[model samples]
Target: MNIPNTYGHLPLAAEAAGAGHPVLTWAAVGVIVTAVGVCLVVLHRRRDTRSKRLTPGYDAATGALVVLDRLSAMTAIAGVTTELGELAGFISLLRVAEARSPEIPFGVIVATLDDYAASVFTANYATRLAADPSLLDSYLALARVQGVKLESARTAITTVQRRIEKLTGK
Candidate 1:
């Protein structure tokens, strides 16, 4: 004699006619499926907010300031080659800073870098160095001579850095 299993995958009609209530089994399956759906919805919402969460405290904030300090220093270089070198390092660090600290609006810095690369250098981060690397020296010297124009960039970077630090209490 085969003993009927209420929780088995076998459908009710497939089992002995009087074994159990098929309706009850179907209702239980419906409840399980609904619970799973609710859980998935909750997790999806949480995943978005999770990345924005920054590590709280002074250390991480201080580290972020260091990157800002370097970016500020990079603005002082009028030399194309030196500036490009600084840009490369700064861009790499900026990506890290953006990921590590949500408080910093890194996209703004990227825009500024993009503008400088396009206008002052007449080339982007990738192509700038490739074009007559020898010209970098002259271009930088010219920019340095006209350094007054870079002051605004220095101010903007510092201001953003301070704002982010203030939020971090660093």
Candidate 2:
């Protein structure tokens, strides 16, 4: 049986003519451009989401805790260092809760424990992280702490919501 070479010789003709080379180059460029555009759009959206999640109120509370950590590490601070240290520790726990929780409303309630506290915590936390060159360890620690807090907060919120539903009878 003899098979007809309809498009089989196209490659040979392309090679001989060299006319298809420019077309191939343009196609490649088009593909690359499209890929890059998609990547940029994805990256931009991720950045926007992160920024929104890490709001100023949230940052402040976390920052104060970080500062307290640093101050505790250093000696010759003002009076009531231990008390301040404890307060900072508490704030840190709260920040951890905020970071891990997906429920935004609860996080916002925790965040608004006075704007000053939130700002201080966030600034200190950011500064401490910035100063430390090794971030992986800190990030992992924060993630773990946040996860526990998140679960606890979620459970508490669910319980409260259930109670409200029971009372309202809806």
Per-prediction TM-score, please?
0.37, 0.32
Model 2, runs deviating above 4 Å? 1-21, 55-58, 66-170
lDDT (10s digit) by residue, model 1, range 132-158 = 697678766756643443444445556
- How much lDDT does candidate 1 score? 0.54
Where model 1 places Cα greater than 4 Å from the true spot, the runs are: 1-80, 121-149
Q: Where is model 2 poorest over a 10-residue stretch in terms of lDDT?
A: 114-123
Candidate 1 similarity to native, TM-score: 0.37
Residue pairs clashing in model 1 are 78-140, 79-140, 80-140
Give candidate 2's total backbone clashes.
14
lDDT of 1 at 18: 65
Evaluated with lDDT, which candidate comes out highest?
1
Per-model CA lDDT versus the true structure: 0.54, 0.49
